[model samples]
Target: MQVKLIFSALTMATLLGACQKAPEPVVTTDAWSPLAQRYVSLVLALGEHDKSYVDAYYGPAEWAEQAKTAGQSAADIATAGSALQAEIRALSATDTMLRLRQHYLITQLTALISHAQTLATGKRASFEQQAQQLYDTLPPQRELASFDTILAELEALVPGEGDLTERVVAYRAGFVIPQDKQQQVFERAIAECQARTLSRIDLPQQERFTLEFVEDKPWSGYNWYQGAAYSLIQINIERPIDISRAVDLGCHEGYPGHHTYNALLEQKLKNELQWVEFSVYPLFSPQSLIAEGTANYGISMAFPGEQKMQFERDVLYPLAGLDAALAAEYAQFLKLMAQLSYAGNEIARLYLNGEIDAATAQSLRQRYLLQSEAEAKQGIRFVDTYGAYVINYNWGKDLVKNYIEQGGSEDERWQRFISLLSTPKLPSSIAWE
Candidate 1:
């Protein structure tokens, strides 16, 4: 009986040993870094197909040439991208940074491949669908009627108006920064923005950017990152410049915004850790969500509370040759209008999906979001050019704002903001708690 029991135990042990699984292969092998490099190079090559595909590339110039040569066609690039992603999926990495970076690469590659396919096929996706697949997030589903409540809230703020949008437009018309004053006003605003940002975060000694005003661009502003602690920022002068835009663009295009965010990544990842993948930025990828969201949120983060209004009241208003007494009213208008930012996505959906015409979309933006006719055109133009990217401004702003404001004190918020700017963060990284 003892021998039979022992034999049974041995048989059980044998079965248990056989059931144990072999270790799975991972993508983080020794060649993984090189694969990452090749991926960036291929993306740069793919960028040649679309003028807006590659937002910035400060990597090895040789790699750019290689991308153009090796992955010359969109189909070829897509095939290579898919194969690389498969290769990455077959491997594992124990390190957190490696895993996150790999995931970021794969996510961006997926967008690139999809874009390539769309370009080749000449078939466009719905705004929401494209946004989800490319930017890695969805714009909140909303209807035109959904904004009536929001417009009512704004109406309660500003009474005695033919139309709330018209009234808001007329009220803000006086605050436009004159053509002659645009440069000096923007320079001063950027200086203050830089000072405030530097007071909160640690950045490299040589970090800086050159500001230029340009016209006829699809977007209002752009930061052309040059890598190695420098950026070239362009502000659109296609329409009348509002006084409030000084602070908005200052924090957005300069300090603690795109310039600051890009510089930190370049310094920490590319320079320090020698991570070559950080050298390329694709405008259509998940990174833009973080970029635009943090930038919009940075304005509030840097200027917090009544300080923004006070700063404009004390400095920007006077600089723009506008009456200072009305700053308070303008400030209130801005506060009310900010609440309706999500409406842009719905309007874009309606317009892009053929539910509404261009004229209808423009009118909806003006009525619900409270913009001037010129501003309405600009808003619609932006939608026409960038589809669901409209969400990056408000939805992204809300997400970043919620994440940073989780802690109580102002310093804690700034710390969280700084951490987010420095790291390779994704949409899920900042999901509301």
Candidate 2:
């Protein structure tokens, strides 16, 4: 009887141990993960809904393809998007890291659905409303008349009989790089930009890019981020290529800008952390605020005030065969004119919401912004196509510059700047105000 009791006790302990062992944690998407499949659904559904929705996708193409094969109708997609958004909203995870990632996915998916609904309904949200919902920030738009002070300042710098616009145009016309020499000058400019960025930010050894000068693009320059630390940089040549644009374009498109931002995120987030959200870049999202702001701010970080002027006069002016004597004057005028940058946002608001007609928008561009007729028309065209995206340039630059410069020393500022470029950050992440 004692022997029987011993055996029974051992069996009971074994049973207790079996009950204590964890029922293997449900992790990894392949093990029937609703979240993973839902994410795949949004990507594919958005792709069908709008051609511009998926900016870059290096994920399993089969997933998107499978969703496309399902052939969900527009109504079906909208419904599914709404349902998934609700699910993500209700979802919770015990792990802190998982919770944050889930939140990011939820926030992005919600925006995707919001955009999809707006697209389907053809109901235009106000510029502020749309920018807030889609990009996660509202621009601090100023009155166009407020820019009179800045324009007056620029007028003094020009000192000409005709309108300030014409004088500024004729003066700037001297700085245009000859068509044949555009490629050579841009190449050197980007090279210097890369060197300067590397001095501060340590990029992946494999990071590299190809530069092309293309025409007829809406924006001045674009960086098409091909995954794995590669980017295709295109410069819009339709606008007269100016020598002053060399450093700005170089820093914006190459080093410490779009290319760097993309590469760092790809390396740190996608590669190391295996976060799938970073794998796809939606063009209209808040990420653009970070991308454009950091990129615009990068120009100054790479080449600060007197240094930029010296670089232009020393390297770019000679390369473009422009008058080096006018570099200083052009620099001052450019600084004064940058204040008028916010004017474009107001024009965009008016044009998009039907407060002003297209012609008036273009006309105002020439008069207030001091753009040439051709340039002004192009500027208005961008506003019509991109809507409140115009705010990304100046607004983004201000936010990033303030954030970076607020840190104590120049080195500390760069550290903050690089940290921004490298991390999985949203506009809200950096908001001080």
Best by lDDT: 1
Per-residue lDDT over 1-433 for candidate 1, one digit per residue giving the tens place of the 0 to 100 score: 0011001112344344433332221224476777778788777877888878898888777778877776478888888889988888777867766766677778888888888787777777788777877888886787668778877877787756677877777766678999888887888888899889989887776566667778877777788887766677888887778899988998998878999999888777776767777888888888888899999999988888899899999998888888989888889878777778778788888887888999998898888878888888988988776777888888888878888889789888887888778777778655422
Candidate 1, superposed: residue stretches over 4 Å from native: 1-29, 156-160, 431-433
Name the weakest run of 10 consecutive residues (lDDT summed) in model 2: 1-10
TM-score of each: 0.89, 0.87
Taken over the whole model, the C-alpha lDDT of each candidate is 0.79, 0.76
Question: In candidate 1, which residue pairs get closer than 3 Å at backbone N, Cα or C atoms, i.e. clash?
Answer: 26-91, 26-92, 27-91, 27-92
How many pairs collide in each candidate, listed in order? 4, 0
The positional error of residue 67 in candidate 2, measured at the CA in angstroms, is 4.5
Which pairs clash inside model 2?
A: none
Best-matching candidate per TM-score: 1
Clashes of 1: 4
